[model samples]
Target: MNDQQLLRYSRHILLDPIGIEGQDRLLGSRALIVGAGGLGCPSALYLAAAGVGTLVIVDDDEVDMTNLQRQILHREQSVGRAKVDSARDALHDINPGTEVIALKQRLAGDALLEQVAAADVVLDCSDNFATRHAINRACVATRTPLVSGAAIRFDGQVAVFDSREPNAPCYHCLFPEGGESEEVRCAVMGVFAPLTGIIGTVQAAEALKILAQTGRTLAGRLLLLDALGMEWRSIALPRDPGCAVCGEGA
Candidate 1:
């Protein structure tokens, strides 16, 4: 690291757990974040600020005025812009030295595989089920660790799925695709702004831990938050022997 970089990341270097070695690992890591909305915003910001070497952001949506409430990466002036572009700008502003690749298009099938294969870790920040399942599949195939986060209404959840670990459950193992889930959107049900921030920040922390290999990750655990009741609970998730996404027979 240069003098400027050493000084910039001195705080991280000062820690016993993250000393200079962990900081170097962070600077050598590449992360793929699969959304650019609320969860993606804070997750990307924290990763960038921590000096992650490369960040690939994928989002096909444009920033909407309604998104400004919790999507901290987009500004009012960026409402009409693609979310990935806006996120790239915000992340660059946070850490200009970090490489930010903004793909303003939906990543699926081959595209998703290529991106996930190149990343050391994947962050599932997408709001919908299809993209989440696709990301999980790609991560499992590539044996990459995934940090997943979601927030809607007064609830949020975060988890890590590492295919490197035995018996670790991917997102599909916990919430199967095509299953019955409450169909609620922020536009209709309303979101607690800080709720997204809380989960996304946790996602970022987990991602960093996975990248630096400095601490234990939540590979087989799921954290659920009920912001309305100020309650938090954690559940142990077991790998499904028949999980369609990452099972032994899958």
Candidate 2:
């Protein structure tokens, strides 16, 4: 690290756990964020501010006026602009040293696998089930750590799926792809704005922990939050042997 970098990340360096070594690891890591909306906004913000070496953000949607309520990375002027573009600009303004590769498109198939393979960690901040499952599959295939989060209607959840751990549960183990789970959109269900921030922040923390190799991540646990009731719950997650994505058959 240069003299300027040491001064810039002195706060992280001061920590006992995340001292200079951990901070250096963070400065050499790359993260792939799979969304640019509610959850993705705060996650990317912190990751960039914390001095992650590189960040690749993907999103096909454009920023809308409604997003201003919770998507902290975008402003009113960002409306009608591609979400990845808006996010890139904001992240650059926060930390110009962090490299931001903004891809204004949905990530899928081989492209998704390539990104997941290259990243030190993947943040699944996407809103839909299909995208979540796809991200999980790619992470599992690449053996990359994944920080997943979701928020809707005062409810939010976060989980870490680290395929590097033999017993760690992948996302598919918790929510099967073709199960009875229903897709709930914030546009339809009316999400609590701060709930997304809370969940997204947790996702960022887990990702940073994985990158810095400092603290124990939420690898075998699922965290659930009821923002309306101000309650939090932690559930032990077990890997499913029958999971299609990460099972023996897979």
Candidate 3:
């Protein structure tokens, strides 16, 4: 770390658990964020601000006027631009030292797996079930750590699925692929603005912890937040040995 870097990240360096060593690890880590909307915005913001070395953000959508409500990375001028491009500009402005690889496309198949394999941590900030499952599969296949989060209406949830742990549960273990899991769109459901920020920030926190190897992450637990009621719940998630994605039968 250069003199400027040391000064820039002095706050993180001050934390006993995330002292110089953890800050250094964070400075050398690569994170793959799978969205550029509500959750992705804050997650990328914090990670880049914290000095994560590399951030690869993937998104195929363009910024819409509606997104300005909760997608903190975009401005009114960014409405017509691709979300990844807008996010790159915003992140660069905040921390020019952090390398941002903005891929304006929906990553799937080999492309997704390759990106996940190269990343130290993957943040599943996507909104849909299909994309979430795809990201989870790639992380599991590559044995990478995944920080997943979701928010809708007045509810939100966050969980970490670290395939490096033998007994840790993958996303598929909790929500099966073809189950009765319905796709709830924020556009249709009318999500609470701050709800997304809360969940996205938590996702960022978990991802940073994974990269720095600091305090215990939410690896085997699911965190649920009911913003309307101002209540929080932690649910223990168990690995499903029968899960097709990370199961003994496979």
Q: For residues 1-250, could you state the per-residue lDDT of candidate 2 as single tens digits?
A: 9999999999999999999999999889999999999999999999999999999999999999999999999999989999999999999999999999999888899999999999999999998999999999999999999999999999999999999998789999999999999899999999999999999999999999999997889999999999999999999999999899998787
User: Which 10-residue window of candidate 3 scores lowest in summed lDDT?
Assistant: 241-250
lDDT values of the candidates? 0.91, 0.95, 0.95
Residue 71 in model 2: lDDT: 98
Candidate 3 versus truth, CA RMSD in Å, comes to 0.6
Q: Number of clashing pairs, model 2?
A: 0
Clashing pairs in 3: none
lDDT tens readout by residue for model 1, 38-136: 899999999999999999999999999999998999999998999999999888899998999999889999989999999999999987787788898
lDDT at position 81, candidate 3: 99
lDDT of 3 at 47: 97
The reply for model 3, stretches above 4 Å from the true place, is: none
Distance from true location, Cα of 84 in model 3, Å? 0.5
TM-score, ranked from best to worst: 3, 2, 1
